[model samples]
Target: MDLSSVKEALAEKSFDKIADVCDNLMLQVASKGTAFHDDWPYAIHLLGYFYVDDCDSARFLWKTIPSSIKEKKPEVVAAWKIGQKLWTHDYAGVHGAIHGYDWSQEAKDLVAAFSDLYTKRMFQLLLSAYSTITIPELALFLGMTEDDATTYVVEKGWTVDATSQMVTVKKQAVKREQKVDSSKLQRLTEYVFHLEH
Candidate 1:
């Protein structure tokens, strides 16, 4: 397989093609029991998986690459560390790992992509934890403007108290009806009568 073609697809942001190439490359590497001495293919493959939000596959590929090869490529190693932070839902660690570091162009692009993904994931986590939060707090957590936060809350069908600057997540009502199965009850009654006799 031409690894250059895979890199080209990644540079072009043709993620689907990159995924296919990475899949084939992964299979080939597995069958041959040979490691990728070159980092480009592995790095691009990792980025492709990240683009599709397939962190599991990305981490799997990262682990499959030889440590000797990874050690030689600081950028790839750094990217992997950042990806690990993402997998563990440590957004602060992710940011801190890449902050002020000079990354390769590809790595920089990957980090940029991850920024949005992290924000979205953080928002989801916050939503689960808080029934009500101020718009400013929501905006800060989501890395969005207050206006955008308000819009997001509205879009999610949550109630907004404009006077209080708070968004309220209406709890979903769960129905818990206690109904016994008639046939099972009848069988139980018959079994009780049989035991009594």
Candidate 2:
């Protein structure tokens, strides 16, 4: 297995190619039983899964990795911690966890990728849950400044109420029939008839 090629792919952010390479390497390891004792393949696989937001598979890989290998490669464990936080919707924790450690270049790249993905997911969830939200609240949730958050909401086609400092998502318009009071109509007709006579 060309581990260096896998590393290169990861550094370049070629996630699909990394997945393919990891799958092939996993198969070879399954058939041949550990060609090399180093855990780079497993670490790379974990990172690939994290990049794709496959938290469950990444956790599975983490669980299966040998204790010695995990100790030797603490970066993998740190990456998994971020993935765990991400899976549980602890976006703040994810950010804090990533910054709490000095990770390898590959791990840092993975963190950056996950941060982008997490921000998108958070924005989607916020939009779904609230038709109108204050700019400050949205900014805090997305870790953005209020101005940037307002801009983002406006860019997504949601209306921003500058006076109220709120972002509003217009719900789909519903057509409703105007109801007429029959008794009021009858009285009005009678009054009109009397006046005409």
Candidate 3:
């Protein structure tokens, strides 16, 4: 595997392909007679999983990492801490882990993208799950300060009660775009007809 290509992808902030690159690297290393190398870029690999919201893969990767590498490379351990916080549903901890780490320039873009992706996902979850929630709780869930959270919710059209400090969630109707592949549907239909016969 070429480390330069991976570095290029990271420099370009091509997060969507990072996980696939790491997956390919893992398969290559796992091949018979293949030996582990010190320059595997495990930290980027782990962060790539988080970027794709694939915690299970991240957990598996963390387990396969050599203890010596984990001890020696603080960045890999730091990336895993983000995965741990995510796995445990510790929203506050997730924010803290992301902000606390001094990430390398290559990993910075993906890390910031993960934080934005997580915050957006949490906001969507809250919109559907809660009719009303407290300011502090909302702040914690959204990984923002109370003031910032309040301002964000207001911008989203949520109403905040000053006296109670409770925010009323404004649910937006999501238009799910359904694009049917006609050829695929036709093939499936033909297969079902043949099976019925």
Query: In TM-score terms, which candidate is top?
Result: 3
Sorted by TM-score (best first), the order is 3, 2, 1
TM-scores, each model vs. reference: 0.58, 0.68, 0.84
Q: What is the C-alpha local distance difference test score of candidate 3?
A: 0.90
Evaluated at residue 15, the lDDT of candidate 2 is 71
lDDT, model 3, position 105: 82
Cα lDDT, all candidates: 0.72, 0.74, 0.90
Q: Quick one: best lDDT, which candidate?
A: 3
| Model 1 weakest lDDT span, ten residues long | 35-44
lDDT of 3 by residue, 1-197 (tens): 45776887787889878988878766766775577787788989988988888999999989999999998989999999999999999988999999999999878889899899989989988998999999999999998999999999999999999899999998898899999999999999999999999
Candidate 3 clashing pairs? none
- Pairs that collide in candidate 1 are none
Residue-pair clashes per candidate, as listed? 0, 0, 0
Candidate 2 lDDT over 1-197, as tens digits, reads 45777778777877756656777777776798765567466655776776676778777777878888878877767777777777787766776766777867665675577667667877878867888888887876676778887887778788988899888965545799989999999999999999999
